[model samples]
Target chain A: MTTPIRENTASESPRAELELATRDALGALRHVAACLARRSHELLGLSCLPGPAGQGRLLVAVADDGRLERLLAELRALPEVCGAQLSRAAGAALVPAAPVAA
Target chain B: MTRTTGARLIADSLVRHGIKAVAGIPGGANLPLFDAISQTPTRIVLARHEQGAGFIAQGMARVTGQAQVCLATSGPGVMNLLTAIADAKADSVPLVCLAGQVPRALMGTDAFQEVDVYGLTIPIAKHNVLARRAADLPRIMEEAFAIAVSGRPGPVVVDVPRDVQTEEFDFTSWPAPRLGSGPAESPGTPGPADLAFAASLLARCERPVLYCGGGARGAGAEIAVLAELLDAPVVTTLMGLGLLPPGHPRLAGMIGMHGAPAANHLLTRCDMLVAVGARFDDRATGDAKRFCPGASVIHIDIDPSEHGKNRAAHVPLAGDAVRTLGALIPLVPARARPAWTAIRASLGLAHPYALPGLDDPKSPYGVLAAAAEILGPEAVVATDVGQNQMRAAQAWPCHAPGKFLTSGGLGTMGFGLPAAIGAALADPSQPVACVTGDGGLLMNVQELATLAELGLPVKILLMDNGVLGLVRQQQALFVGGRYTASTFAARPDFVALAASFGIAAIDLEPCRDARAALAAVLAAPGPALARIPVDPDAHVYPMVPPGAANHEMILEKRHDHAHS
Candidate 1:
């Protein structure tokens, strides 16, 4: 029996809060990887790659037709990515939040 | 006087002057000439395009070492011939371009197919004249040929009006002048005073260098004598690539934008630079101010205008390269400096701007080296522009002067095959080989039929990389790896194309035994083609990008490991 957490403000809705939390989690993952590689000899003892690697990849969850093609084109145009690709997987459930004026 | 059409007189004059073939495309302006061609003993070859006709004539002239004639109608036809004519002018090939003009009455009336042929060709041609009357045809034709062949051979134009070709006229032969009859005298030996002055400079300078140009071509023996007397290193321009043997200790490679590093370094470091018959083109001198800053320049050439045009000279000797060098040989006092010799030897040891991926036995450099070794000093070599040109300039060992001919000044892409055709014509006794890249050869591939028909013993070595290798190299280095339209996915099978032209063809892939096949093709009496397949992803090293200094060359591009 978990108590339902209340939303802080109408502007800061649950959906917006969840999106910001996901972005922070992705950034933290990359930051921690870089720190560990720098201090590998003292810590995990893993060797670092020779050249500079790019930032973490963006995962856009979209279901619209032709959306993947457009996103792939945009990503291909980027200088960081030498190449690009598309993939499909099982959809994840979205937790419902308190409704706001729509 | 017996009446004859202007066209008939012109055709008869060309025949009388020993011209057996005429190349041109039939058009309204020159219909009468075409009609006359059909009835005359002279064979008229209808070229697909005006430029093609010019090249054909160039080929004929090159083989014959005589003036080859090409015809073109007014306006666009004449314009299309500009490039070939410019090439002829630069390479000193003898050619005659007879361009038809609108009738004199409607000359400036903005008539259809009307353009000022004389005015347009003035800059490119050695000489040009507008025939005002039908009677002028015979005289103009004779003068055109004489002008084309005499004094630094180049193209001459005789613009005949459309109506003049139809008009009837009495004809007579123009009086032929003696060889040395003009105000422009044949070059004499350098005067005693000038020779003594040059000797003084040579005597004082410890690290003197002799830089020869194409003008010293026919005087190879004289150059050898001069080099021996001075104990000076000899470096050549692109046009003078084969002036000195590469094996000679005194011989430094070519000097310029794509020049050898040792040559450029020596040029900058030398105490005295004796420039013989070489114009200091901007490409050779990176920045005129910074070029040969430490050297005291001594310039000699037949053309006086070339003397202070690009770089300043401390001593200017205006005369032929051979005569000047010969005269100076007697005056020069032998001065040997162990220090200078050691410097030159050390510079020689310094490895050239590294050319990666060319170390493989099947590389273009290997093929060039093998060919040079097989042919030795006897075989004449011609090259087309781009990577092949640079590679040949760098790797091929030309043992004698005038053995290597290329479009140096213009860097024309379609030059090699036709030039080889011309070179073959110039000396039918010798075997001529044309080394060209895939992109350069395709520019004028139609000449394959010309070679077949001529039955000339010219071998074409095609390096097929599928892409415009030089342009791609540029894109990769400067354009941040964005491959543009330079890449080609599909290319015609050159071997099959050569076979269709009745030429014996051999296609050699990488790691294949190309030596025997190349030898067989070279040994063949008639025309042949040897197509060598190169890596599509391969790039020529020691490349200096446009606007970049020669010292800042990129030996190789770094690629991502994952992509490889």
Candidate 2:
């Protein structure tokens, strides 16, 4: 009798699948810069850090401060980002500060 | 064929021949070919300087063993490539240079940027061509590549006009050109009569020596066999550094101005000198009339002009090194003479001219010795000019053929890193180690990006002495230590610079940890840098002053004061 070939089940192979998914998700999210450039305003600061499951951190700062809330609302509507949060931080350092209750 | 410009055809032909990269400096006359290249599949790399372009092409050719092309716009641009092109000729590297010429329509008009490139390069190049028409481009390029790489490889120049490059042609393809066969037949073995005479002379001689040079490089195994057969010590010229293993039992260090004391001592004492494929250059044999005062010389080389050019030879055998050695190896009998062996052993025991403070517990010699031990004999070592080159030549023990590569003849300052890149590209399996000084490394620091982009695993050892070591030493010994422009300050952080180029770099200084640093760098799987800071005042000793007699070599400075 021939032995059956071992097959990877979805539950057992989630890590590799998650890696592929995360890369695609982050790649799409990064392309948002080009999209925003078509709308208005020049990009002030843009940073990207790799994360898990085709997910990655992207931070974009604009010259105008009020634009952050509107940008967050647009990002939340996108399918790639799992969640969106916005807060004001010191502009010089570009560091994330404690979230101001929204 | 329909009417077309020579430049377009040449560029098209080169592209057809699988040329991917062309390094050059653009100018008026050669702009046509540049236009064609810009439109063709070939990518043109603009060099900051024409000389740099020539060396870059040389590096590329040395790695590929194929003819790499360089272009220069006319006059000074073409002249700039002369040194590197001649270097390629001497080192047997293959390259083709396209020099822009004044328009053929205005021939002999002394057009702007016009120079007689062919006449200027006649003595330096393997071949040269001045395209008479647009139709000549395809055939000329084919012949250029053929001549550049055939037999003893060298550079070939093709001068084309601005009009020729822009002219369009209907020719679909370049016809292949035929190349001539190998060098004309050279006398292989010494005549029976000459062999008998040489044998008789050797039998009567008390001390006989074998001096080898660059011509003997490809015949290492044969040279070793001949050395064993004759039971004589072998010494080489500077260009013949890696021809034979430096540590061979029968091998003596290099012979010449900067040659070892033991080798020169043996040369002075020998009764018979057998020169093989060596020209006995003035640097090798100072005052040829006085060199080997006691010896009768037997010279063997393929070039007949060199037979008696430098020194008188009793037996001049004109042949390739392999064939000449083949003829001589059999005539000499292998007899165990304990007396001769004892003399050789005695010469071996005579300590090498000591570097005054190299024996210090912490010194560059220790670092070199450790490196030699770790890298072993098979490691390919390239050195930049100055004290580091001299020190590496004296201290590093090369055990195999082609293991030591340096810019010996040209003594190029920024040669180490790029040449190491070439050596690494040539043989990926072997480890390439470059020993460069801080001053020399900074000369071509831009090459760090090339190394990183190519992902070559070349290990660089920087000797940071905060001064141009050789110049400083010369000023100290000859000039009154005025220092002049030799002082270097505000050096860049090499580690950070290397990091910016995506290369790993470690400073082997502050930690005073050369061993660990070297080991770590050597063990790394990619290109890395290890900077070792030496005292700025450190000088290379045992220097024979320029134009001074060899016997008057200053082994050490007379006082603590620096010579200016």
Candidate 3:
């Protein structure tokens, strides 16, 4: 099981939630964070959970949706990011951790 | 059976992979690799800095469309290479970067010159590996080449430890390499259904435009055939500059920010946009939602990952441009949209790009146009970033693919000189020209010594504006003209500087006829720098202000400081 890296209360402006599954390499997490900051995403919270086959997952939230489309495309295109998607539930905590393969 | 050190395996791999040369500087951690390389027939060009080494390798890869190698030591050496690595990633250049690290045991121990290179390169490289054992060298090296050149071509980092370099294992049998047929392309031709679907769209559209990018370089001939079939105009991104000759009748000029006015206007009006190998970068698409609101898009790219990432594709053709274009051409019906073609052509006159001092040969744009004429369309041109790069993009006539090399995605400065050297080395027969500015030239001026040593025929066309022209222009237009810290208070005598590096130099500022001086610079030199002094306030027109749409460009007539 894992916990959210951070979380924030709702603001006046629109917000979005993002989750990413990626390869567990050095600086992989930092790359995603930097990209998010560059696109001006608010980055409300982030959480890392161990994934299948030594992979890693991150849950993120942003304050603005103006540049989210391009931001998502860029995030998905990152070499380390294996998967990126929008969360169906707004402002949700880290998705329930999946059971690690025995 | 024979046993050999990991160092020997690396050198042997280069030979097996057909890499003829490498560029880098030597350091303590990398001394063993250099020593091993010395035994091989591969020639090494020593660069004064690691950044120059990486750009030199990029130059080779850009020209040959093959993976080239650059070497560096650990810690600071690897740090210096980060910019070039990121630049390659942005532009899709194929490069294999080999860096030396402290021994595996000393990793994470904060030993002397020990840096976490693997972490530093993760964000910038296509793929990277930290070689933990000597036995892994052969497979890792082979995989490095395969990954760098395959898929969307990009740089790969292989960090080898000092102790791993000396370790040896015996018994001769090596793992077989996974050699594919060619670089990443379609698994097979598009299916009959998909080809028919694309053909139907082409047949129906009246105002169709073919948008090409660097990925479409190999499919130029096929693109011409398809354009003729549809009577469509071709517009290219910065990377796709030479896919169509500058003089081609169907060429509609470049699109996006700082692009030709007619091209940007046509992009908005086109009913159907056949996007080939372009990902619709923000610079090209302006505002993604409204980019081509009325057009139906048919995006064709070799990489499946690029499809529908930025712009939705009505018909996404996932394959190599050549194969996909070839298959679809047979199904396309022949027709000519003469009316649409004439409309776009007339738009050029309607929105003419004004050159304030074009009649003066010493002007930045004028000098570039004059040089392009003197060198003919065959000369390979590389440009450093800022106003000079934009001017060259607008003025220089690129006749073929790989002829115009610039840092398009990353917009890197200090790339021109070393890349020009690499191009000259790749093809000694071709004339290489590097267009740079005073600010950019100073960034990698050390490579002037390297150029003198090789004595390669590379002409450096320096536009001396005495300030960061692009930044100043932006400040003038956007920031109330404060102009803080953009101007160089003290400047170098470029001619004397070049002479000190053993290169001939020419100053066009005082010449009665600048054209004659430029011609001489091109003709009489193994390596020379021609300085053309330009007005600091002169601006490149037809610019799309930051955060504006592509079509909403500020024309020359609109600017109060048009000729300043």
Candidate 4:
């Protein structure tokens, strides 16, 4: 896995956050983490909470490099994932937070 | 309803799915599965090495576009199969691999032949499971096939304990096979608005190019229609070679590192690049920042994960290529740009593909071209990695998808012979050629016995350069010509070696008429090996160094400034 070096455009922010709903399977989370690592996105924070009927509510904060929308679209496309939407977080939201080590 | 052992259930599942053959080596742990397989008519190709068995399965899967099977035992057996599994994942070939494991009770204990097969295979396989109970066999088999053949097809591992294989179980009926999780076969049709935007983009473009990858295999007809409509040239990634006929007028040729100079230059000049199914891999997009610098990309791919993974698409249409292109065809109008076509033609003529000693049958490039010519356009060619593989890629005229099979993403050496065997098995009538180098062939030389035993009509076109050609070439160009262990201190006499395996052999270098003799040998009824001697100094040209842009190519000495 390689981290893509970010080249900032005028309209883009340096970092962004996303929340995903996925099947409560380790494989699904592993796949997501690996993909983010491959894309060079830093996972600022992660929270895996139980959702309806074994579904997992995964909150992830990633260092955005202008391709957040594209990344969100790709996350939603995952078979194990049902929904992916953007979110905002302050530095205080970093609970057990740090880049998720792949 | 029938009461049967887990092994029987597995064999029955394969039979139910219409699997005609399997490849594997029977070991202590997997013997029950082999025994059950024997009760059926499924031909089991016994390979000497487990890795060879996995590749043989890959060969069949690549050719048939179906999930094929390979079996191995626990521990070392599964470990040996890892490379092929990784290779399958990299190339998107569908494979369902079964490995026998230790008894359920013995797992996690340091019992003989016990290892964490599930943990090791997780990263490499699309999905993997361990069967703790015999009753789960039918469902596991069904899901395995489904997952293996689904979106972005890849290998799936099913690890069954030795005890599970022997345990008897009752089932009401064998579960019908199912398609794995993915978008609907008929994806949400591209909206009219999307098509309109694409049409408008096409309408305004002066120099538009259609770039494709492996995902565009079955969309050739649609691609041809779009190419005609837009008057644009088609450039394919290595895996996308046959998406257009070899000599199609609109084809600008393959693009990437080691790609044609004309095609790379065309990419640099294009205003709009409609990348259908191409992920813009580093190999294809050298220095991604500079690749197709000014071109606006419209990426179409079934896997949404690929949409902006590498290169962002202005219009990211997520649908099947055939359907997506089918919908867009009606909106676009046909127009021919004479100036653009004339420029492309001039570029091609300026940088010709004709290399030194290519007309000599004994040379590496010459041998590949001659073999391809003799075999005709329909022949399936499998190539091992490095120079031999690239030469085959450059010379072979692939008329259809699946005809030219090689490990593109993984670039696995020792892939040719076994894959050729699998190809031959998949299509018994079509002639198959395994183009391999000495360094690669020796990696799994043990498979020669398997090939001899089967006597399938797979011709081994062995190019004996006596060195790891590509690495040696790089060493010469970049490492001050200090050849380390690239050269073989004592190369095997391939002719005598072939005879030792009970197969016919021919030495092309010693022949009076090498081309004719080579053709004669290829035309023969059974398996044969032809040793074509080549200079170790031969290099594949028009190469873009690791981090250079596509247009920043190091051309052949004779053609350095030819395109200008």
Candidate 5:
């Protein structure tokens, strides 16, 4: 089986999380989803929660393909997003000594 | 406090923003918005198709350097406009698309003309918004215009539900009308440190090239000055054409797949590639790994995502091109590079871009040259896709930035006719030229009726090859000479077609003096069409193969197939 590119926690496959600080703008969640959907196979999981004073937080779990820097830049470019951060490692790293797929 | 309907507020907002005219078609959900616009002084140019409407608005926006508006209703209207919106975003044209949605309750109930416009436009548009409440109309309308012309200019979509359009709300004083949110307010405004880093890099390199794109359109003078100061040659992308004048001493010409051989070869030898607002697109840089292989890049663009997306840069100065170039110019010392000049001259002589039969008025290049001479340097030309577009790009004497309009990023066919109409409508003083081919003209032939109705001074030059010339050429070269599905079995009588659309027609095939006939048609005050029969076997010269490097070009006439 193929190893995970970026897995911060214990998981069966490749996964990385991004925590987005956003404000409650119209269709703000859809903007994030749209950005992820444009890339081939990026979105694995996503969740949004409302915070104080119209502020909100979005947790996105993705299959990091070493393009997360550009992906984060795209996300942060949105007007609705106040900030975007990769809660996982800085860059995608290969899982250590995993079994090869036959 | 006064009260006004959401539609009236949107219309008033348009008027307040100084929008003189809008282009669109009326539909079920957008009737109220259209009616509100009718009540105001903003004139509506009705188009046959919503796609035509979008392109018309795009033409105006491109010419005026402002955010022009286009309207479309739900479902099919929105779907039709998606191409233009995507085109605007790709080329960074400032446009505001106001699309109507079904009433709030009927949105997800599978109503007659309802689709998820918000979801559909999200990926294509630079910014997307949905008006769920009437009270949000003022803020939404204001932000739409601001966002469109802000930073790197691009299209913005605002999806208005029918109920939201008709719902009345208390009106506070309007927000200040805005053209942009300020170039410095956006992300990637370079600091002093970044400018210093970029300047030092440029000052050190002996063979420097300033590669520009559409984002640097507003800073042509600065680019010219920067090139002179650094003793560098300036190379532009397709979108960045016409930024420098025709015979500017530093202009190395356009770069990419179909670019000039001198410009393409120059990239391989440059010691430094200072990309000004250029994105290093695949078309501009073939085989990215091999592009500018010997050079260290200093990329300056407003978008941070483009910094390391394609080719890695040694110095990434993320900011507005005008400000960054201005800041960097003063720091670099002026010097003469005779060695680099000699190298550039030799490369140009070795691989000159040859347009044979240019002396004849009937050929593609000759027709474009004759038309350009009669129309003058002030005229704006819009080209359709494929061979016609490439021909116009290579031959059209583009005098300024916005004068040369083409669907560069999307390469969409059927963009020429309506865009020429829009350009004429935007500025009546300058003549507009629409250079198109048989296949592209047929794609949007319906707009000919619209052109007749408006009676604008648009000259449509038809290069009739009876087939898709570019596709046929590629099929001949790469696909082993099988010209399948590229040829048109029965071509329409274009001269008669123009007459049927209530426009003047001229065919250069039998004309004794084709140049005089063309000059007469282009000089006429109203709409006209000229059909020039082109040889189907004619191929655009010096094409770089799909996966090959810029230097590896397939020359013209090398693979000629003698078959009908």
Candidate 6:
């Protein structure tokens, strides 16, 4: 479900991440990964971690060219996916610049 | 506790789901499952090709608006069924595909008929499960049907190993009753504010066009009511045909490439586009970015992803057509826009929708019209892609949803014949018309034998041109008419071929009264093929020439571009 608004389009971003609650079952990640690949969203990174029994969390980062909202909707629609939400960008570990090691 | 093999459980699941017939071709990997299903009341249809079986299932699903089943073995069988699965996904058809795989022990040992059905189907299917244990049969089968017909319905693949099928499992009882729901029950509904906003927009916009698509099927009355309420002209996409009667006054005719110029022209001038359950497919929306450039959108669809994937909806109402329209209808007041009506009429008069030689029974459009007239309104039409498809879209008078079945989203060439068979099987009482061209017919020609055996009232209107009509038309229009592989070296004598297959066939080349010949052939009984000799130079006109704007059609007549 989406909030009905006149200007609901996702703002443009070069990269974005989606956090998903998924079933901890065989081939469940395949369904999530396939959704991104089908839409030609270049997968930047993916990490899956075991949660409570029969539950898993998938954090996926993809190259987004202003199509993130639509992609988020598709990811949420997957059967194995219990929930999916766009992650806050500032929390991403991979920043463009970092302090050099001396 | 009841103890049963996984195969028996699957058969019981099929019975519990109210499936009377399942289509597929059995192979080495799936013999156990087939044996178990045979023991049940469900009749198994042995299709000549896996692809044929898949389309047969699609046919039933499309006609009945419910989930249908198809079976296939591993490796080659799964591979053959892939196209149909992809087609179902593209067109949003609900299908449960049960595929057999190698045994658990030999699964990764390079065993005979070993293929990774899960990985191959992941991208195409709504969801796919690899049933690794015999104990998982009940849950897996229930989930497969649930996922298939659920939101934005699509095909689901359930791959069970041969060992799992034969291995005995103790199951207390079936998990649930009727895991399947009709096409996901149309997702969600629009909020009251959303309806008010949409109604306000409708009231404000001077020139509004209601664009509907496949998702709008089974909501004909709602669409008609909305069109009337808004005083708007309705433009249906290729998949959205029969949402309203052909004679409906508000119909601007089908839109996009290979669509009517009047409707295409009207689209350019509309101020508001009320897209009812329509996804703006590239074929329907030529140069997506440029389609309805100045118009504000009120997008309504069952799927959330569709809303802003292409053109952004000014007021996106994410819900099924019926519920959304049912709510919005009362909010909007009835009014007439004479200017809009006059504009539509002027455009229509300039570009008369009726094709040239439409009355000639030997012509492309003529044969389909004759078939529809002879078969009457109850007839279901399933068309193969290309010129024959466009002709049927243009000429046929489909009165309701599901009456016109085409591989709209996938545009699969071999879909018509087998799908027609499935449609006929869904309701043997009604007649089915299969429209196909020379190119598409050969792709699934084996189904002709299936049609012969079934002896259903499926009148195949074969347009036999020496070339792949659409490809040749494209080559002619865009490629400087190089005349390459589009032309066939030698075509089969369709009449003789039909006779060889023990099915009656008639060629209209030499017939003095083609109308009467078509009538007699269509009316005679079981299955018959009528071959109409189409001119190789003939092409579907008002084409939006690839990558062009919808307004810039390559019209067949100069008057199409002339201002009235």
For the candidates in turn, chain A alone yields TM-scores of: 0.30, 0.54, 0.70, 0.70, 0.68, 0.71
True contacts kept of 6: 0.29
Q: How many residue pairs clash per model?
A: 2, 16, 1, 1, 0, 0
Residue B30 in model 3: shift from native, Å?
A: 0.6
Candidate 6, CAPRI quality class derived from DockQ? acceptable
lDDT of each: 0.68, 0.69, 0.82, 0.83, 0.85, 0.84
Give the runs in model 5 whose Cα sits over 4 Å from its true position. Answer: A1-16, A41-44, A89-102, B176-188, B560-564
User: What lDDT is obtained when candidate 4 is compared to the true structure?
Assistant: 0.83
Q: Residue B440 of model 4: what lDDT? A: 97
TM per candidate, chain B:
0.87, 0.83, 0.96, 0.96, 0.97, 0.96
For model 4, the superposed segments whose C-alpha errors exceed 4 Å read A1-24, A29-86, A89-102, B173-187, B558-564
**Backbone clash tally (model 6):** 0
Off by over 4 Å in 3: A1-102, B171-192, B354-360, B561-564
What DockQ does every candidate get?
A: 0.00, 0.00, 0.09, 0.18, 0.17, 0.24
Tens-place lDDT digits, model 5, residues B340-411:
998999999988887767778899999999999889899999999999998888888888999998999998
How do the residues B255-274 of candidate 3 rate in per-residue lDDT, one tens digit apiece?
Answer: 87788998898887888889
Q: What is the total number of backbone clashes in candidate 1?
A: 2
Kindly list the per-residue Cα lDDT of model 6 for residues B1-564, writing each as its tens digit: 998999999999999888888999998889999999999999888889999999999999999988899999988999999999999999999999999999889888878878889889888888788888889888888877777776678898999999999999789966752322222333667888888998998888888899999989878899889899889999999999999887898787899999888999898889889998788898998977678877989999888888887778878887777888988999988889999888888987887765878788999988887788888887899999999999889889988889999999989999999999999989988878999998999999998888898888888899999898888888877777777899999989999998898899999989999899988898887989999999887878878988988998887754322211
For residue B47, give model 2's deviation from the true position in Å: 4.9
| Candidate 3 pairs with clashing backbones | B186-B320
lDDT of 3: 0.82
Ranking by TM-score: 6, 5, 4, 3, 1, 2
**What would the per-residue lDDT of candidate 2 be over residues B86-106, giving only the tens digit for each residue?**
777666667899998888887
